[model samples]
Target: MTLNTLKATEAATLLLDWYDRHHRDLPWRVSPPMAARGALADPYHVWLSEVMLQQTTVQAVKAYFDKFLTLWPTVENLAAAETEDVMRAWAGLGYYARARNLKKCAEAVAREHGGRFPETEEGLKALPGVGDYTAAAIAAIAFNRKSAVLDGNVERVISRLHAIETPLPAAKPEMRRLVSELTPSNRPGDFAQAMMDLGAKICTPKRPACALCPFGGSCRALTIADPETFPRKAGRKEKPLRLGAAFVAIDSSDAVYLRKRAASGLLGGMTEVPGTGWTARRDGDTSIDAQPFAAAWEACGTITHVFTHFELHLSVYRAKVAQAVACAEGWWEPIASLKRQALPTVMKKAIAQAIPHAFKPV
Candidate 1:
């Protein structure tokens, strides 16, 4: 089929039919049959799933989703939760900003929006962390509005189906336009999910199952035999390396001194060991003189963690002191409860390096 013959209605119909048979069974979603029978999806669940899904794989998100639902069970409950508790629950998820905004958005919805999600894209966009894509997704999937949902999966599917040549970051606009044209008014939720499922299970990044694709006959990239190469990305510049130091102070009671990060910037609102500022240019103070309090500070080794923009190498230091040692603004958390703290992956890595069994599951 040619580009002109890429009938929107027919494509949507085919994809929706495929979706009815093969959509992923997720914890947060109501099945198509249930949806058709007037079972509307919970906006809270949809919003939570979308937030967790950002920059995270579905497999990685499943357990976390289930855990959050079990813990809070409702938006009101989440809103009432302590910010520190929420951050602890979000540990290891990465992208700490999302966790912080999740709490803020929940509080806003509970307090300002009466514990209900905004049904419209614009209203949803006003919520913390709900950007254009997230708003569109929630509006369409949870509310069944006819909004065009264009996540990375949908973008790749559209780019391959239409054989869009412009590399990504630049081609996103054209891809959105094409998705808008194809988005149908009826069953918009199912249609949106169908596009995503196709990209994930069939039109994958490599070796797309073209023969099994519902749009095989219509996909322009399939005709050219290079569907994997569509949605091309520009070359990425090497991430700059940054250096820092982490100080792990264990008291006589086997409690580790930890503090909360500032409420802004990377890894904000999360817990960490006291350390020197990770400046943009210089490595943190690696000398024992920079220790939080005088103790037998020993080099525990170094840990390298990669963030989105830079690589961080932290010089790990360990010091065991008496429980009564006066220190800066931080608490002495029992080492056994380390898993319950809102330590980021990098922090966990540093702790593991200093105290080998610090984070081991009991």
Candidate 2:
């Protein structure tokens, strides 16, 4: 097995050596020096961080990771955690289903597996939300199993090193197989981390620092003088813009009307002000007529938030009413306590549009 023309063993060695010197010091990962001294990250830490890191940046996940560990210091603690509390902490993370599934996976580990994570890839995959990539990652990083761990960073590194022209999705299988072959039996976990670090630091999507790359001597993309052009991706289709309206009702004492969202769709199990259903069409309702309850609803402004599959435009409205109102399935959250609620980013944006000082620094 070889990476381009170099023997796979040699390629792994070069990458590992570079990693020992320059690997990133991330919150969920053990440093190369620690790994060299035979330390590995806890399985719970690895799993939680992996789930949080899905489609999120390291910078974004750090605070959330720290918050989670502080709240539920162990897998059993997270399993027994109130789902509402979990959702509240996961408000800004965007992908709500992952939060739900994270709770489920934790419960499964706590109850079914005796609070110990599965050590094998297949065993981990059997857990909820643990797909092939996540399972492989947990097995390698947490259990030190010889499993192939290929995330986005490693994908770029492989696509460039082999100059594979297959566009992604179609190219992923080939990339996985190549990574499996290059994974060393001993220190396999460190080897996997090294590949990821090299890709993140040296073989970046933009102007990569080829001078610092360990694989520069053998990278087919670099030899061809256009490394960035590799890992070619198919064009993205334009997301349909869905239009709706949101109502922000405030009481005499400055509390905002908010309610819990249904627990099974976009922004599931989060909090939001009343809003019209998002329908995909240019003529979908975006007027004050779509308000949850009638008041002297005054139109203020519109806020647009982009989701993975669609973009949303919400026409925001606010009205102040007497504090002696009664409502079922909702609450009047004081403006000071709104930040602690499980309001998604879109809802926060809508609230901010209605009340400019809604999320001001305390």
Candidate 3:
């Protein structure tokens, strides 16, 4: 069947039926049956999970989600919580900006919005870090509004269902329009969740299970072209290479020197070891001479970490200074307590490279 030939109501009903039988029981989500039993999705949980899920995988986010809920339990609690504490809890999740904005949003909701989330998409979008997709998701799931929720999974499903030819980003508007058209007024939340679940479970990117998909007959990609081949993307540009140096100053008691990053740039407000500024040019001083303090600095290999736009290669150096020699602007954290710090993954890699046993279990 063609795109126009497939009735929106029919497609929604089929997918909802499938979803009723098989929805993933996630910690943050109130499944269809749970909704039927008078349970509603929590806006705070939905917002937190959506923020964490950006550029991150579901498996990677589960523990963090649980941790946040346990720590705050409500938007008001999160607003009252310390910013530094939130950053520490959000450590290793990458995207430090999200953590910063998460704190700001919680404060806004508690202080400005009277401790309640807004019911519509526009109101939700006004919150910090809540973008178009996030606003739609929260509105539909939490408020039962007829907003089109299109995340990566839904994008794949939409692009293939209509065989949208335009590359993503550019193709997003058309895809959204189609989704809005297909989104039913009754149980719009369930319809949106059904699409996401269908994409994740059946219409996967690689070798989609066409035999199991409810929209198998109506899908344009399945009929005219390969289903997996739809949702075409533009070619990716090569990530630029950035070079830097990391200095690990350790004392006799197995403690490493650590400092906080700047409040507003890459890895903002996170813990890091002494290091040179990352630069794309070799003229930059990524050498031992750029060490934070004078000591017997020895080269200890290098660490390569990939960021969104650049790949960083940091030359590692370690120095065993006296226990009396304390860093002027930073604190000495014991190696065993490193896990509790707000260190990003790159900083951890640098520490591990220097000590080798810094992150090992006792």
Candidate 4:
């Protein structure tokens, strides 16, 4: 075997052994609190939390996860909720796509599996938004089946163990393969958990706790005395800048009019102010050609937010409405209750700026 293969093999053994002893007690890892009234390690809960945890920190996701469980309680509950409710529930949590997928996946399981989560990796993967890693995780953790799981955590652990210098995105396939090789046939759940714990606690992205790591002496990166540089990253490209206009309309009752986004793309299916697609702020391009609601409208200030590949500049406008209209599909949500409604961070910032001049902080 190659030296890379040799190191990965040894690292997996030591890391799993360390994990079997030092793993933290997270609520999601334990058996149900009580048989009569408790949540179990079911595929539904596993899938839900896994989906929420993507690109989100554990601390950030904790409150949102608890709130969701309180509101929906089960996959069927979430599946049955209106799309806007799901979007709002997912407010503040970026990556709106996951929230949409959560509902779609739940509904699919409900309709096709009679409200039961799929027990096999293949079955789980067939559901909407269930990727390879997610499918393997649910299949192993919930169903106790042996399926190879490779996520960012696993990739970090495997990359360091083997000291692969390839940058990410491109390096992922090989990382997956290396981890799959180490995924032992027995106790696959424990193995998966072990790798995750090792990544989060010891083989970290920054200055790894090599002294505490079980494979400290054997880790190729550690042996080379440069753990931080092992997982080399490619250079980043500059994000494009985009600009748009947003109309925040308020009625006599202090209710703000929010329109539901189209069913796909960024912030899809979420609530937002009436707006136009992002474009350059050049004079000719930004025609404010006011609609009927312009009677109460006034140009406010602007807010800026950046996405993965684009920057958005929103020119804010305020409008007043005496009577509500069924302007497309949306809610006439109270401005005071906007916090409860899920607005994207950008739109929420715009609303906070648009708080009525009378009530605006003195």
lDDT tens string, model 4, 279-331?
A: 33231123355332554677778888887777887777787777776565666
Off by over 4 Å in 2: 31-33, 279-284
Query: Model 2, range 1-362, lDDT digits (tens) per residue?
Result: 22556888888888888877888898898765677799999999999999998878888999999999999999999999999999999999878999999999999999999999999999999998899889999999898899989889989999988889999989999999999988988778888878877877789899989899887678888887599997989999899878889999998999999988888887888898988877444435788788787688899989898888888888889998876368897989999989989999999999999899999977
- Give the best candidate by lDDT: 3
Candidate 4 regions exceeding 4 Å error are: 1-13, 31-40, 279-292, 321-331, 356-362
Model 1 Cα lDDT, one tens digit per residue, 1-362: 85559789888898998988888888888975787796768999999999999989999999999999999999999999998888989999888899989999999999999998999999999999999899999999899999989999998998888888899889988888888999999889889888988889998888888899988678888787688888889999887788788999899999999988888887888899988888545567766678877888999899999888788898999988867476567889999999999999999999999999997787
Runs off by more than 4 Å, candidate 3: 279-284, 324-326
User: Local distance difference test, per candidate?
Assistant: 0.89, 0.88, 0.89, 0.75
TM-score of 2: 0.96
Q: For residue 54, give model 1's deviation from the true position in Å.
A: 0.9
Model 3 agreement with the true structure over 13-122: per-residue lDDT tens digits: 88888888888888898865778885769999989999999989889999999999999999999999999899999999989999999999999999999999999999
Clashing pairs in 1: none
Sort the candidates on lDDT, descending order: 3, 1, 2, 4
